[model samples]
Target: MDLLIAWLLTAISLLIIAQLPIGVEIDNFGKALVAAIVFGILNAIVKPVLLVLTIPITILTLGIFLIILNAIIFGLAAALVQGFRLRYGFWSAIFGSVFLSIVNGLLNQVVSR
Candidate 1:
């Protein structure tokens, strides 16, 4: 039940992110849902490994490299989802990832309460 709620919230967050003027675009709610799932998968399975491998760089950048790593995953998700796109390419991915994290955090907080 918690996982399902998280998935739906992530989908909703993606849709909301797309509506913003940040160059993240989703063709429809269905696409948003797909993108959210893909994003979550990558974040779950890939992010940790990447983080461990990039520890040196991450430390050098004082943890800022994690944000770039997130952007890379975001771009990967957009590439995997046909109807989800970043209008401004990598820049859009960066902004989209940041906004997605923010929106998801806020939404999860609301739902948890």
Candidate 2:
């Protein structure tokens, strides 16, 4: 149940992110949901390895480099998911990931209460 709720919230966040001017585009709700699932899977499977590999940079940047890692994963997700596009390259991915994280955090807070 918790996982389902989280996934739905992520999908909602993706939909909201798509509406932003940052050039993250989702063709429809179905695409947003699919992108959310792919994004979650990528984060779960790939982000840890990336974090480990980028530890030096992450430390040097005082953890700020994690945002860039997140952007990379976001771009990968957009590449893998059909009908979802990061139209502005790395910059789009960066902004999209940041906004997505923010929106997801806010939604999670509301849902948790």
Candidate 3:
């Protein structure tokens, strides 16, 4: 259920991105769901490993680098998912990452509270 909610949020995010100045296209629910699941799994598994590996840099950057790492993870997830296309171009990825994080946080808050 939570995962489905996440997928729905991803779909909305993709739609919003497409409408924004960004060129992000999510063709359908299947792509959105795939992107969400892939993103979640990567965040859970790959992010931890990367964080540990980059602990020194993370500390040096005062954790701000984590935001870029998250953006990279989002870009990677979009790259891995078919039918959902994202042409983030670094800054766009950052914006898209922030957007996704905000939307997901709001949804979580709304549902949990």
The weakest ten consecutive residues by lDDT in model 3 span: 10-19
Q: What's the residue-level lDDT of 82 in candidate 2?
A: 92
Candidate 1 C-alpha lDDT tens digits along 1-113: 99889999999999999999999999998998898899999999999999999999999999999999999999999999999999999999999999999999999999999
lDDT of 2 at 96: 96
TM-score of every candidate: 0.97, 0.97, 0.83
Model 1 TM-score, all chains together: 0.97
Could you give candidate 3's per-residue lDDT for residues 1-113 as a string of tens digits? 86677667766666665566665667777777777788889999999999999999999999999999988898888788887667656777787788877777776688777
| Clash statistics: count for each candidate | 0, 0, 0
Candidate 1 clashes between residue pairs 3 or more apart in a chain or in different chains: none
lDDT of every model, 2 decimals: 0.94, 0.95, 0.77
Q: Clashing pairs in model 3?
A: none
Cα RMSD (angstroms) for every candidate in the order listed: 0.7, 0.7, 2.0
Off by over 4 Å in 1: none
